[model samples]
Target: MLLVPRQLLRAGMTGDVPYYGGRFSPAQAYAAAHPQPRPAPPPPAPTSRADQQLAALQNLFAAGVLTAEEYQQFAARVTP
Candidate 1:
């Protein structure tokens, strides 16, 4: 296990361990000014009102809330 300089650590048997997020990191992890940019994640696909209704109908059928005939009729209105 890495250890922080005794001067940096509080007066205790254990030393101060550096952390990055929730995990430990080394004190030398950053030495100088640096910049690294990450691309943003792609946006989610947009959904149409018909598509939303279709998904709702499918869920209802899966949950046994809509009969097969009712689901088929509703699905026809949403699908091309």
Candidate 2:
């Protein structure tokens, strides 16, 4: 007697399509037939007051001016 796994048996019986096996399934084929919409470009990074404060804190930490404890405290305060 030949035995197939339940998932394979179910897949075979049902009309549902497979994805990422080796070849594209019916859904994938259909999607490929129709062109997909492109995603919008990401917004520019913030240059506001909060961002400035964060940048200042980062610079201070990097410059070895701010101790670890002071950096942590400043980070906690500045982080919205």
C-alpha RMSD by candidate, in order: 13.3, 15.0
Return the top candidate by TM-score: 2
What is the Cα-based TM-score of model 2? 0.39
For model 2, give the 10-residue run with minimal summed lDDT.
12-21
lDDT score, candidate 2, position 8: 79
Question: Whole-model lDDT for model 1 versus the true structure?
Answer: 0.75
Q: Please report, in order, the local distance difference test score of every candidate based on alpha carbons.
A: 0.75, 0.85
Highest-scoring model, lDDT? 2
Model 2, range 1-80, lDDT digits (tens) per residue? 55978887888887665556688877779999998889999999875987789899999999999998999999899877
In candidate 2, stretches whose alpha carbon ends up further than 4 angstroms from where it belongs are: 1-47
Per-residue CA lDDT of model 1 for 5-70, tens digit only, reads 666555354444433676434433443334457789999877688788998998999999999999
TM-scores vs. true structure, each candidate: 0.38, 0.39
